[model samples]
Structures are given as C-alpha cells and as structure tokens.
Target: MSLEIVDSCVGCFACEPLCPNKAISAVMQPGEPLFFINPDKCTECLGDHDLPQCAEICPIEGAIVDEYGEALNPLGSLTGIPLHLLEQMREAECRQ
Candidate 1:
C-alpha cells in the first residue's frame, strides 16, 4: 500500500521529506513539478506510524492517493514490503 501523488498535485513539495522511508522524490513536469513515490522503498509508514504521515500532513485534500488511486483514509491500502526484509536486502546488496 504505497501512496502516490496524482496529477492533481499542486507541487507544494509538502510530501517529500515527510516520508520516513525516503521514498518520495521530486520530478519536474511540463508545467508544475510532481512528486514520485518509489514503491520499492515505500513502507507505507509501517512500523512507524499508526497511519500514513503524508496523507495526514497534506494540505491539499485528495492529493495523496493509494496504489489504486482511491482517496487515502485511515487503514487504507497499507501494503508494502516488510521493513526488516527490505533492510536485509539492502544490507546484502551493500556487502556485494
């Protein structure tokens, strides 16, 4: 359950650093910039928050969406790889 920023994003850059997993990045679009969430890195704030911090802090309503583009609500689309597995993978890759 990764969060995605739709085309409706106002480029407010509000969701970038707020991600605990460091999954969000800024991408420049034709007119306004957009934020991209790396699904591989996103943990949906699992093991950290009771809910997604991005959706909680976003000022623009409906700007943050779940993988299915549905409005993010509490307990919505909380799917992502387990944090421990991801960290183990990273550690193994770094050792190689």
Candidate 2:
C-alpha cells in the first residue's frame, strides 16, 4: 500500500533521500510547511527495502500513515516519549 505524510509531519527531511524510488519530495513553496509523498511514484519501498524508508526514518510519530489511514510510526517508534506522556504534555501546554 502507498504511504502518505500527514499534517503532523515536522518537515525534518529525513525520509526524502532514503526513498529508493524517489517518490518522496518536498512540498515547500512560498508558504508551504511540510513535505509530501507521491502515491503514484511511491511503492512503500516494496522491492528495495524491508519496510517503507519514509516511515522507517521519520522521527515524528503518527506523521506517516498508510493507505488505510493507519499510522505507520506509532508512539515510541521515533521519540522515546510514550503516547500517554506526550498527550499529557500537550494538554498541559494548551492550559498554559
């Protein structure tokens, strides 16, 4: 299945070069904020790697989702911070 970089992406640019099929590219323009994956060109690294290179390298959890809209990199996959902790921090931040 093809992969999609959701709005949660931090635009770290870590996944661009790792793609063997050159499917991933920057979506940056004058005011654009993040990168995007080309579904037409994306193959989920099927023939080139064991897992999708974009998902493997992306540091943001829940940023990269599969065709079915499921996150490929779940909590604790990138950063060591757990989902619960992150949620707590976010809630606290909002209260600030």
Task: List, residue by residue over 46-72, the lDDT tens digit for candidate 1.
Answer: 999988887877766557888888877
On TM-score, the candidate that comes out on top is 2
Candidate 1, residue 11: lDDT = 85
lDDT of 2: 0.86
Per-residue accuracy of model 2 over 1-96 as CA lDDT, tens digit each = 589999988888899999998988897867665788888999998879998888887888899998899999887777888778988998999999
Candidate 1 residue spans exceeding 4 A from truth: 73-96
Q: How displaced is residue 66 in candidate 1, in Å?
A: 1.4
lDDT comparing candidate 1 with the true structure? 0.76
Error of 1 at 61 (Å): 1.7
Worst 10 residues of 1 by lDDT: 73-82
Best by lDDT: 2
Looking at model 1, how many pairs of residues clash? 1
Our model 1 lands, by Cα RMSD against the true structure, at 14.3
